[model samples]
Structures are given as structure tokens and as C-alpha cells.
Target: MTTHPAPAATEIAESTSDASLARTRRRSAEIEEQIAADPGRFRVLTGDRPTGNLHLGHYFGSLLNRVRLQRAGVETFVLIADYQVITDRDGVGPIRDRVLSLLADYLAVGIDPDAATIFTHSAVPALNQLMLPFLSLVTDAELRRNPTVKSELDATGERPMSGLMLTYPVHQSADILFCKANLVPVGKDQLPHLEQARVVARRFDERYGRPEGTDAPVFPQPEALLSDAASVLGTDGQKMSKSRGNTIELGMDADTTARVLKRAVTDADRHITYDPAARPEVSNLVLLTALASGRDPEAVAAEIGDGGGAALKRAATEAVNEMLAPIRARRAELAADPGYLLRVLRDGNARANAIAEATLGEVREAMHMAY
Candidate 1:
């Protein structure tokens, strides 16, 4: 029999790229279809770094998806990424308090503790241990090429990146795989992190999963649950972030929300418009009002036409306050009893630890390191 030639490296690369693109397109369609159809049940993993209070950006970006998925019968895991805070920070000052505050915000936003497991990253020892083996599966070039890490470095303007910062994507892989989460709700900007996690999962399965006639993978390759929510902007017309102090906190009172919006930057034109390129500040406000009031941004702009910046700001402020009133009330009620918050964390940690321990045992067995 004549031997056949193996596929060239370039051909292999092209094939992989095409496959990835197809998967992405399919996932996008799935998200759109999910709106009309029940998602059945899937394990979803998503979280936040308890850097500060959760804001509108957090709400529209991922928190809303979390609540929806949890209610849709999906087993959701919300990790308070406490360990990720040190990636850029000089110290972990009052991280405990911050974690509690973040948890309170989750509760306030209707993240039912009984429905979704909310655990601190540091509380799960096996998750950290899972990182050690995963680091070897990734390369330096791959980590450096990650857009999220590059953006962090560029934004910080610092040299000699911290090892933890560089390997953050890998650590994130462990976080997702430790729970074997097959669905991760993320914005388009965060797709890279989720993709890297998929790479890690594939690598591990290829290296150790195939045994004789059996193919058993320990981790499920997660897909991105892309959201259709509009991009939320800070009061300064920039990306909404806690570091910039431009966020509208979820727990803000009515007056505080109005004062913040009143100072929001806008164009000097008397008429309202939705041209983001021409007037980002005004467009940002329109987008915020649209999200808060469940109206189209263009419609919102048309309704406020010839009303000037004052009217636009007033509408945005009213919409935000109206949406936040009940949330703020619930948050205040939850925040009053610190003991209740602690108990929730403790219960979540215990459940998460049990799942992580089981996963770590399987990982150890696959690597031939199990005793």
C-alpha cells in the first residue's frame, strides 16, 4: 500500500481556524435563539473581582445574564475572584470587606444564594492547585498575545509584568475547569479569556484523556454566552469602571444617582441625537437610558429631540433611579445583617469546596499523580 503524506502545518492551522470560527458563529446564533427557546439546563461559570461596588456596567455586562441563566434552570457558579485583585494592585487592603460588599450587590441584584453557588476564589484550595498543571500547557507567547493582559499592561503603563498578571489567563482556565462549566456568559471583549480556557481544556484532554479505547476528558470546553446588552459607558464617556470613579453604583440613592448624572459630560448642542461618533457623551446617556427603561436608544434620542442636554440628563436620571429603587431597598435590607451575609458565604464555600475536591481528585488521577 502506498503511504499518504501528512497534512502541512499551514493546512492544519487553517483547518483549526475555520473550526473555531464556525463554533463562534454557532454560539452566537444559539444565544439569539435562546431568547425564544428555553436553554434547558447547562452549567455556567462567571464572576467579578470585588474591586469595588457593582455598577451599571456590571449589571448590563454580566450580572443580568447570571440572573437570567440561574432562573432558566442553569447550574451557575459565581466566583468572587479575590485572588485576581492582586494581579495589578500593590496590596490586598480590606479585600474581605470588598468581597462582602460584592456579595451584597449580587444578592441585591436578585442572585439567589440558594439557586446559584457563590464562592470566593481563595476559599477553594483545589482551584489553586489545578493551576500548577495548567501553567505547563500554555506558552509564554500565547499569554503575551492575550488581549486582556496586554490591555491591562498598556493601561497600567508599568514594566516587568507580575508573573501572576502574565499567567492570569491560565489561572482563569483553572477557575472554569475546576467547576467543569460548559457555559460562560461574557461580553465580546472577554472572549479571549474564554478562548484561552478552551485551549487549556483541549490540551489537557489530548495529553491525558485518550486511554486505549476510551476517551474521557476531565474538563468540558466552555462556550461564551454572548449578551445582546448595550455597552455601558462611564459618566465621562469612557468605559465604565470603578477605578475611574465614573460608575453609577447599584446601591446609590435617588438623589445621589441624579447628582451623578447631572454632572455627566454632554455636547453643547440643544437637540438630542444618537450619533456616538459625533457626540459620545450624549450617546452614552441615551444608551444608559435605553438600557434602564427597556427602550431603543434611537427612540429615546428622538423623544428628547430639541429638549436639550438638561432634558436628556433628566430622563436618564429618572430611568436609572426608577430601575434601582427596589434594588437599593433590597440591598439596604441585606446589608443591615452582616451575619446573614457571612452565613451565605460560608455555605457557598462549603459546597464549592466539595465540588472542587472531587475535580482535583480526577485531575490527579489523570496526571498519574493520584496516591
Candidate 2:
């Protein structure tokens, strides 16, 4: 029987050449090696949207890595992507409180504000201005072809896509390039956004930069620094997400954390094992326990052998609460001093504005727009 070709498959395969995740992974390893050898040579940019409280998934996924990089002597720039909250959501939802809460979370997790530049998106006007020139470097077709953008749009359902949503990747380029950050920490899903940033940097240098080989490029084509942490699953065996009600938020108290872990889904199998493929729910619990307790997952499962789900839940709850205790205590202390948090943001904003203005000036000179 005659049949039409699969358009979706074709698009994905064609897109894979430009955004090959495998290629990024190889490059990530090389970047990691170089960073290890000479950490001072790199500047990293990473951030989060202030949509809600940071969670355990975020802790293992990105926060811990940020601290590691900072301690390794790499310069870190942490952005509170306050503006991105509206990319898909309808309202900002107490954004001010959320930003403060996020700052507290970062501090409690060992993100020393003294060492890292922590700023909000709205605070840096020049950074946002870079979006105009960066947007011109890319095409509408390229933006629409972005798998991440398409997936996000699909998630928004029938809501009409906003101009901001359509140009999310471009804005992200501005985020990376405005600070002239040479490295970015990202998960696989975000590689596409990072790739778009690299493309913008290259195009801008080619079209408006100093004569070929006469001067350094206007911006560095930032490289991806992928995390080696295992994927963290929610208690329900699904991706840990706030909207899914599965996340163990960093703001949760010990008692609340225990209560949440207690109801986590586990299989009927009386024997506990760490086979993620065969028993995702039970394995997820064991994984959480292992991560928190700093033990291997298999060992954690062996310790709970024949104890069934009860033993697993108890182990996870205790381990998690113990690990989070100091963080929670520090968070409590920080919460009591709102003035300190404001000062941190204000200082970071001032520093960020200075950097963005400097970069924008370079861009203007490169394009002959400087008067």
C-alpha cells in the first residue's frame, strides 16, 4: 500500500544534525577536562526561573554542581530568570517573594553570594537590550524548528504563543553572551538553547565584528558543561516537578518531608530491589535514599532487603531530612534577615549592569553603532 513519509521523523532527523546531543556530550567532556586543569580560564553562567520553590531534584540536578564549580575557582554568574516566568505561564505570581526565597535557597545550598554574581533578569537593562541584535542574527524558521520551544509551546496547550515565548532562545543567548560567559551548565534538554546562543555569537562576530582575524571575536561561543548527576525522580516515579505535586521542595520542613515520603508510591512486591526498569517506584525511593545518604543505590537496596517499601521509605525520609537539616536551618536564618537578601540582589544587579553595559558597548563598536 502507498503511504506518505513521516514528517515528524524527517524533521527530527534533519534537526539532529544541527543539534546533535551526542556531539555536545563529547565537547562537554573536553571542556570539563580543561576546566579541571585551569578553572580560572572559564566563566560560567547558569540560572533558574522564579516560578516556585527550588526542590530536591534541583539540588542534585544543578545547585550542587554550581557550588562545585564555584569552589573549583571558576567564576559563576547566577541569574534569577524572573522575566522568563511569563514565557509560558499566565501570571507572575508573587514574583518578588519567589525571588527572595530563591536567593535564600541558593545561600543555604552553599552558593556564596561573595563568590558568585547573583542577579535578576529585570535588573540588567543592557542584557535585555542585547536581545534585539541577537534576535536579528537568527531566523523565524530556526526558532520554530527548536524542539525545546516546540515542546514548551505544546505544553501551553491552546494559549496563543507570545512573542516572548517565540524568542525564548534568543533571550537566552543574550543571557549567555551579555556577560561574555564562556561556559554554561545545562541538562540535555537545554542544549538546544545553548546551541542557539553559540550560533548567535558566531553570527554576530561574522557580520559585525572586527576584520577577520584582526581582533578577538566580540563574544565567546559558549560551551556546554553537562552535569553527571543521575536523573532525580519524584516519589511517584515520575519526573520531580512542582506542578506534578511530586517535588520535595527545599523549603519543606523535616516533618513535611517525612510525611511526603511516607505516601510515595511503591510496588506490591515484598522484596525490595534497585531495578529501575523493573520497579521504578521502589528503585526511585532507593535512589533518593542513596543520594541523600551518600551511599550507592544498590547498597541502599541491600540494606533494606526484605524490609519492603516501609524500610525503603524510612531510610529515604531519614536520609533526606538529615541532609537537608543544615540547609533548612540556614534558610530559616536567612529568612529572618530580609535586608541581607535585598542587599545581595542589589549588589549583584549593580555588578551585572556594569558588565552588560561593557559588553553592549563592545557590540556597538563592532557594528559601528557607537557614537
Candidate 3:
């Protein structure tokens, strides 16, 4: 017979808890370092509402990075956020179609559905159930302060916001935590929501949820994957947005892309330089030129200085056209193959459902509602 010394139950419990905390800290540090420098971390979640097609801003800002993450071995979860669109408190359609359209773009741009899972917000019942307990963890005051909600409301001039609009971030928290996402790729502006997710996770553990043992945090506090690229501007030099009628869709035709670039705002001084503060318009053009052409922005600026802002705009336009030509072609090819896109979304949704089912079961059991 094998003999072993019996450690006290208290001693055993403390050892396990301490080890778990240490593991969380170590994993957090490692993942944060990677997000700060590298982008390959499993459990990264990012997505958009089906209000519109993606644009150039999304590509440089994150779409490409998402594709990179999926290929690099991280299991990516892309939320279609179909329900988020109805938050406008106005227009909506049969989400089933729009979701498929969005999936087309996702796949066309190399978002391998086989690699990344795409899910709809409305489809996951258990995930949505989280909003109930989740709401109890936070207050109305915090929700009112959500900058995204405030901005959307201000822009739309739609006051008396729908309950959906107000509670969207809480819903967002449920989305991330439901999957136990550890890393969320986001730009600077979206940090607040991630912070809220962490707070909700911490609150859940503190209130009723457990980490590994008695009374510990349930969700891992995710870190922001800060983006280096500035937000792409529309032709008017403001943020590129569909509402502003200035966005260039990722799948737009070459002729259309060129036309939009032609009208783009350039520096008034005529000559191009890298001084963004003194010459933001022309600098913006130079920046776009550099990104599109895969060359040094300053070098492109120097070459164009020989002519003027018009010259810089022309060069930028050409570079943008070239870069977009292939993407547009790929989008066209994918559009023709609608069946493939459908499969991608279907497969993604299944995977997301699986993840949600597991977490949702655990959550219900913890709260004594499993029955």
C-alpha cells in the first residue's frame, strides 16, 4: 500500500488558491506583453454590428490584425452583433440576410471562418441570460458614463435611448466573459468597455462567482490590443464614417476607390511635409500614401514636395487604387461564392454556441439556477 502524509484541509486549500492566483498573474503578464508587442493570444474576441459594411479604417485599424491572429494559431471569436444594430431605436431588417452579407466580407478579407468563429448576439440564449446577474453587479450611473453610448446618442440626436442602447456595454461584457476571452483587440477609444468587462468579472467573483475555488474572480481581466494606426479619415478630413458619406468600403470597386481618393482633402500650402500639426490635411494624404504604397511616409512626402499637395494626392490615390484592386477582386470572387460564406458563419456560430453553452451552464449552476 502507498502511504502519504495527510496535509490539513486548510493548508491544502491555501496552497491551491495561492497557486491559482500566481498562475493568473503570470498568464496576464505574458499575454499583456504579447498584446503590447505580439498579437497571437488565444481567446481574442472582436466584432462589429451589422449596421454597415467595413471600411478602410477597419482594415488598418484591426481587420487585418484579426486575420493575422486567426492564422497565427489563436482561436478567434467574431461577433456579428446583429442585435446591436437595432439599438439605433429605429431602422432594422431581417438580420438573417445582413448577417450573411457581413460574413461574406469577413471571409473575403481572409477571416477564415474555419479558424475564427462568427456568432450572432441574439442566437445565444445562455450568453444573453448573463446580462441579468451582470446588471446587478454594476449601476446605472456607470452605464450613463459609457462614452460610446454618449457619442452615439449625441450624433444621432436620439434621446430617451432604448434600454438596449443603454445596456449595450453590459451586453458586451456578457459577450466577452461568456467566452472567457482573455484578450480583446481594440483601439484606444474602446478601452472603457474592456475595463467594464474586467470590473464585472471581478464583481461576479467577489459577489457569487468563483475562480478555481471558493470566492474568486470568474472572468480573466482582458487587456487592450492598442493599435498603432491613426483612425482613417474620410474625404472631408473627419473620421471616415458611412453616416458622413465619406467611407470607402473595403470591397469598393477600383474606379470608385480612385474617385473617392480624388476628392480627398490635401494640404492648402500646396507642398507636402510630415508636419501633421501644421499641415494635417496634406500630412493625412502623405500618411495614406505611405500605407498604401508600403513606403516611408516621409520619403513619399519628400518626393511629392517636388510638385505640391496635388501631386501628393495623386500619388496617394494611385497607391490606394493598387492596394485595393486585389482586395476588391477577392471580394467579388467571394460574393459569387455565397454558399462558402454561409458555411463560414454557420460553422462559426456553432463553435460560439458550444463555448457559450459550457460557460452558461457553469454560471447558472453557480447562481443556483441550474435546475
Candidate 4:
């Protein structure tokens, strides 16, 4: 009998990646159909860590989709992941201000506080309590293998990985399952994190729910709600990140935005084109213009063809400033009334706590620990 060698690690990893993408795409389609057919059946949980002011990347990537979901009548929960700021970073700098700033950004972008539940991670105790039992559902090796955690740790450079950082996926699982959120909007890179949440939900149900003769599962295995929005790159042609200082913040004035766009990197070749692979920097600018102006990127590129990089910068600056004008005005109004922002947070936190408390009660009962 001939023995075949095991597949190489890289080969296996690639295969796994492809399979995961396929599954996510398939499930996203089904969920989309379900949402359209019965808009009331799904609940969405999506959020951002309060690191800094909101940028164009946040606007185009997740914020717009969030508005679409809320308008679609889906029950939505937006968690301000304040605790997550320290996951890979040193300290939470001006965390309170950032949280309020995030809230203002949401409102400016048409996220109605009355329609959706917007809450914070630190405010929801029962939500965090779910982390205790969830931590036991997965092993150390499994946690280490989580790509999101590994990437975050790798980004931390010489800093030692903290315990919380290592178990970040479990914390995220708590974020999703605590509110029984069945739909999570995620990009392709975040699919693994959502998969880990699904694992926790399934394992918890199989081990704890069935033995109690429970009529319903303790947690819902969340599905990925993929966004078709292309990833927004920064002016420097890298991933748009606040830490890099390459983002056009939503609150920036028109002059500041113009100045930032003037410095955007582009090729020496005068001709403008939208070949993302070859001319990424130039293509990025074109894409920003297209997104802001509601035109096709390729068409934008074609229109700016032979106009060169300077013309592209001018176009992007104009389009972005025009697009953000109304949002900036609204944000300014919100900023003037800090008291109102606090009220929104207070109400959202209270609502979130009540829901989390109920979920935890059920969890404790299922584990036979409720006295």
C-alpha cells in the first residue's frame, strides 16, 4: 500500500481560505434573500472601536450599509467597543470623547437612535458576563489559531500579548451572542471571527441546551452579512487607518480636506488610470472620487484620462468636500450639545443592559448554575 504525504501547510491554508469565502458568500446570499422576504426576522450587531474621529473609510465601508439595514426594518444594535481599544494598544486615550464622537458620526450619517440600539461595551455587564462561560467552550490552541487575534498581536510589535488580547475572539463572541444577534455585517477578513462566534453558539447549544430539554438554542449562530463596498484605501495608498494619519476625517473642514487631498500619492506618469494593481495610489484617488460623486470608478478614470494626477486630486477633493458638507454641519450641531449625546448613550446603555440581563439569566439557567 502506498502512503500519501499530508498536504503542505500553505496549501491547506489556502484551501481553507477559499472554502471559507465560498461558504460566507453562499450564506450571505441566503440571508439577503431572507431579509428581503421577511425583514423582521433578523437582528444585526455591528460596531467599531472608539479609537478616533470617523473617517471616509468608515463612512463608505460599514456606515452606509448600517443605514441601509436600519431603513430595511432590521433590528440593529451598534456596540461602541470601548474596551477593545486596549486590546492591542497601550491605553484608551480620550475614550469617552471618542465614544461620543462616534455617536455623533452615526447620527450625522442618518443612524436614528430611536430606530436602533446603540450601546457601549463597558456599559453592558451581563454581556461581558457571557464571556466567562464562553471562554470554557474553546481551547488555547483554537484561540491562538484565530487569524484576527494573530494579526492584532503581530501588529503590536514588541509589546507582549495580554490575556485579553489572546481571548479577543471569545469577547467578540459574547458581543454577538449576548444580544442574540443573528446577523453580523463583516468584511471578508473578519469572517473567521464570526465563524468563531458560530462555533461557540453551536458548541454551547449541543453541550448545554439539549441536555436541559430546552425548546430553543441558547444562542443563535450568527451569519455574515457581507458588504459589496470596495475597501477604501488611504491617501497614501495603504489601508485607511487613523493611526497612520492618512485618513480624511469626517469633521475636517473643506480647506483641511483640500490640503489633505493635495498631498495624496500618485504616479509620475501624467496619465490617470484605474488599474488598482498597477497604479494603486492613483486608482485609490479615483475610487474616492467615484464613491463620493456616485459615478463609476472606471468611468471616473476614463473621464480623468490624460488629465494626470493633479486633476485627479482636484476632483477627489471637490467631490469629498461636497459629499461631507451636510454631514459635517450636522456633526457640528451635535457637538454643540454634548448633553444630548450623553442622553442618547444613557438610554441606549439602559436598553442594552436589560436585554443582556435577560440573556444571561437564560444562560445561567441552561448551565444549571441559576439558584
Candidate 5:
């Protein structure tokens, strides 16, 4: 009889990490192929934090994808990540109002409540319960290595790091898994978070899933649905963010939109061009115009050749205002009726709670805690 030596801890860890990466890559490719073949066949989970009103960046980046996916008959769940707001902010005093505002914004932007399931994070207690088991599946080193966490910490400068902030990626896994979501639309920068969720799903399934021959897993590994939308820049030409105060809110009135655009930074060049690197500020406006007017960026530039920064800004402003008119009107209508908005959220929460409870039952059973 021959005896095989057990692998060292470091070797075991390395092997596990490599396997996780392989699974993620394979799953990602499968999802892409699946989407191409039949987009309506998969469940999608995507959402936003209720830190503030959404902007053009949110519109182009993820909301647009949500609308399209829902319309295409994909089962979509839009989460109001209220718990995540405290991950960075010092207080939750404003979160309630922000959550309501976010819901209104969702409605204003054409997300039909009847078509997609929209729910608040706090409304579903099962998701938070799942976080405990999920936290154990991920490692401290892995959480610390998350680029999103690192960037956020670095950006905070001297702010104290909270345990919640470090484990946010794990919480995200709970969010994704609770819905059994197979597809999560995210930007390139968010790939790491999605990858972590996939890792957690695979780990849980391997540990507590059905017998080997059955191959039944309670959670389905989610894959990232990377968006191809052009990056939306802020008024200062940086990434559009509410914190930076450079974002053009989706609900901004036509006059406010135009005023914000007028203050947008641009170069001294008299000619309009589409050189993002050399002229990011000007190029940003051109791209915005293209997105709003449904015209090519180069074509927009050609239409305004030698028109100077003033002319380019004016044209972009006009295009943006025109695009925002209907959205603003809809937002106003939604915001005026607080009772209706509350009812929408209440109904969504009930639906989400039922689904979450069912998932939690399975999770508990798999972990031998059913008694």
C-alpha cells in the first residue's frame, strides 16, 4: 500500500484559490454565452445605495440595463441597499428620506414596479441573517485585498475603518445569493466584489450541498454582466458622484441641468474634438451630448467644429435638458404622492420577504440548523 502525504496549509490555500478563480472564469464565460443565446432565461440582481439621488452616471451605467433586462422578460430584483449606506457614512439619520428619494427616482426613470421586484435591504431580515454564515466563508485577508474597499478607505483619508466596511463584500454576497441571482450587471471596477460573491456561493455549495451524485446547490453562482456604456464624467471631469457634488441628478429640472452644464470644465481650445485623454473635460461634454442626442461622439464633434468651448457646452446643455424634461416631470409626479411611493415599497418588501424566507429555510436546512 502506498501512502500519499497531505498537502501543506499554504499549498492547500493556493489550490483552493486557484480553483475558485477557475470556477469564476468558467461561470463568467457561460453567462455571456447564455445571455447571447437567451437573455430572458436568467435572473438578474442589481441595485444602488440610498446615499443620495442617482445621477446620469447611474442612469447610463446600471439603471438602463435594469430597464432593458426587465422589459426583455428577465426576472430582475432591484435592491435599495440601505444597510450599505452606513458602510462609509457616519450616520443613518438621512437614510430614510434618501431611500424614499431613490425609490421615486427609480420610478421616474421608467423602472415599472409591476415589471421588476424592488425592495429595501432592511425590509428583508433573512438577507442579514445569511450574512453571518457568509462572513465565515470569506477570509480577513481576502476582504482587505478588495480593491473597492481599499479605494474607499484611501479616499476617506483619516476616517476610521469599521468592521462593517471591511465585510461589505461578504454582505454583498448575501444580497446576491438571497435572491438566487444568476446575473449581476456591474461596471469593470466592481468585478472584484462580484467575484467574491461567486467564491462564496461555490464554497457554500461545496460544503453543504446535496450528495455528490445529486450536485444540488442551494445558491447559484452569480456572474458579472459588464456594461459597455461610455464612462459618465462629473462636472469637474472626474467620475460622476453625488459626494463630489459634480453629478447631474437624474431628476434635475431643465434649467438646473443647463446651469450645471454651463459650469462644466472645458479647455481653452476653440475647436471641438473627441480626445478624452488630451481634453477630458471637453470630451466629457461631447460624450454626454452623444448619449443624450443618440449621435456619435465624433459626429457631434464634427457638427460643432471650431465652435469653441462655449458653443460645445451650450449644445451639450440643450441636449441634456431635452433628455431630462420627461424624467423630471415624472419624478415630480412620483415625489408628490408619498403614500403611493410607500405602497410601492411596502408591496415590494412583502414580495421580497417571502422569497428571502424560502431561501433562508434552505440555507438553514443545508447547515443542519433546521431544528
Candidate 6:
């Protein structure tokens, strides 16, 4: 006992931990520099509320790109915004089933289990927590001025919308900022929400957090990834949507998809053409046909031009049916064990929550708002 003093365990552990953190910091900075240079490796937080199953509109608009991105090395997170359903409605009656249906749809579309993490909104409380402090960053008038909220209110004829719906953008900011998400895959209408997230992240960082030089950007202002593809239309040639019950669900079987497409409106002129403005109905059909055939719409139009609207419709129907055949089979297989879908949700929730918790902690620490 009189010979020598022993080394402290705490000192050894701290030394090793500091070394590991330095290595991790250097690696992360390198990856960030690479993304800054290449651009497409941008991390994105994108999702659809699990109010219903995904359909052709979702496929053509965003999900299609997401599938391509996953294959192309983009880090993507697919969220089932189940919590937002209650923002408009009163309960969660159909949401449980809808969530499962959405899961089946995602799996069918080749959203690899390894590539994208899919989860429900409510499952990530850390994300929701961002809502509290985020609320302080914006004015009530700013939320009221959001054009998208106004459009939804107009479309649904819901006067005096819920506070949750009014501030849905804040929640969306939470969805992005919680993951520290920087690149958002968005349609034109969604530009405002991304704008709001940028504002809050910038404002909060300026007010209570640190700035990077001349000005600080706490959050990387997410850039909009735009799409010029024709939107998927429903049977009646209106926008394909779940609320209208006009959507051809991706999870539906081949027979069901074929049946849905068979009933969709086609051009009355019969000759195939690419005039979307003149014949949205037929043009939508032609567009779907082109995507399914892996040919340009101009090419599809040329091939089917001799045929009248009925023939064009029939050809469009057949092409869609052919493309959906395997997807339908895969969906049925997934549907057999519905629990597998729930498991995906659960696993995604765990991962998203962990990341979100870390983000929320940093946000709280920055603002000195931690309780």
C-alpha cells in the first residue's frame, strides 16, 4: 500500500472518450464537405400522413423520386404523419389501420427496409417537443398568412381550423429540424412550409444561438427538389386524391389497379397527343402509360395516335396493369403478415426518436430553455 498510487479509472475513460469524439467529429466534417460539394447526397425528411394508403398521385409526385433517391445514395426518412390526422379531425378511428395500409404500400414500391426509415409522427415525442420552443419564434399572424393552410381550409371548407392545423408548419419545422434535415423534397405548394422552417431555424439561432460569421444559419435552409412530371389523376380526371376516393392505391392488387385505370377518363378525340392543357384526362392517361412503358409520352402518343380515345384508354390501362402486376403480388404477400408492417413502424420510431431527442437537447441547451 505504501509503494505506489493507482491510476484513476475516470481519467482513463475520459481520455479514451475524447479521442473517439475527435475522430467522429473529423469524419462527420469530411462527409459534410462532400455533401456540400456533390449536392445530391443531401439528407431529406419527407413523408405522407398515414390518413390513407398511398396512390398514383403520391407515386408520380414525390414517392417516385424518393425511390430513385434511395437507390442513388440519398439519405431519406419517410414519415407516416399519423399525429397530424387529429389536427383536422376529432379522433384516431381509422388511423391505426391506415398506418398499416400505408406501410404495405411503401414496401410494395421498393422502399427498401435498409434504405429508408418509416415511422408515425406521434411515435417521436422528441420531434413534437420542438413545437414548444418553435412556437415562440413565429407570430400568430405569420401562421395565419400561410397560403397552404388557407388552401386546405378552402378545399375542405373547414372554417375556424384547429390550432394544431393552423400551426402545422411549426410541427413540420419540428419534423425537419429535429432530424436537422437540410434538403426537402417538395412540390410547389409546399414551398412555404420549408420557408417557415428556415425562418424559425434562422431566427432562433440568431436570437439565442450562435451565428456563423456575418450571419448565422442554425439550420441549413432546405432547398426544394422540384418535379416537372405530370401529376397522377383520378378516374374522373380530377387530381388523384384519397379524400375523393378516386385514387388507384399502390397497395391494390393488379386486378384492382386495372379496374381503376379502366374507368379513368380518357381523351374524347381518341388520337393520342401530348396536349395536357387541351386534354388533361387523356394526357394524364398517356403520361401514366409512358412512365409504365419506360418510354417518353411523345413516344407513347405516337404509338397510340392512330387509335381513338377508347384504344388509347385501353392501351393505357394495359400498360398500367402490366407495371402493377408484380407490385400487387408483393403487396398481397406483405398484407399476409400485417405485423411486419407495424414492426417497420416501431423500428423507425426508435431510430427517429433517438435522433430527434439529440436535436431537441441541443436546441434546449442553445436557448437555455431546458427544464
Clashing pairs in 2: none
Q: Quote the lDDT for 241 in model 5.
A: 89
Show where candidate 5 strays beyond 4 Å: 1-33, 155-160, 211-215
Give the runs in model 3 whose Cα sits over 4 Å from its true position.
Answer: 1-41, 93-97, 152-158, 211-217
1 versus 6: better lDDT goes to: 1
Q: Report the C-alpha lDDT of model 5 over 1-371, residue by residue, as the tens digit.
A: 32212232232234236565566556667776776678777998988888888999988888877887777778889999999988877788687788889999999888899978899999999989999888777667667667767777788894768989999988988889998998888765676777778788877876677433445798886776766678889999998988899999988887888889889999888999999999999999999999999999999999999999889989998988888889889999999998999999999899899999989988888888888
lDDT string, candidate 2, 32-117, tens digits: 88878999999999999998899999999999999999999999999999999998777999999999999999999999999999
Error of 2 at 47 (Å): 0.4
- lDDT tens per residue, model 6, 219-322: 66665554555677788888778889888777776677767767777755766797789988888888888887788998888988768777777777788778
Q: Evaluate all candidate structures by whole-model CA lDDT and list the values in order.
A: 0.85, 0.88, 0.75, 0.88, 0.83, 0.75
Stronger candidate by TM-score (4 vs 5): 4
Model 4 spans > 4 angstroms off: 1-16, 155-159, 210-213
Model 6: residue 227 alpha-carbon error in angstroms? 2.2
Which regions of candidate 6 deviate over 4 angstroms? 1-41, 155-158, 210-218
Cand. 3 TM to true fold: 0.85
Score residue 349 of candidate 2 by CA lDDT. Answer: 96
Worst 10 residues of 5 by lDDT: 2-11
Q: Using Cα atoms with residue i matched to residue i, what is each candidate's TM-score against the true structure?
A: 0.90, 0.93, 0.85, 0.93, 0.90, 0.84
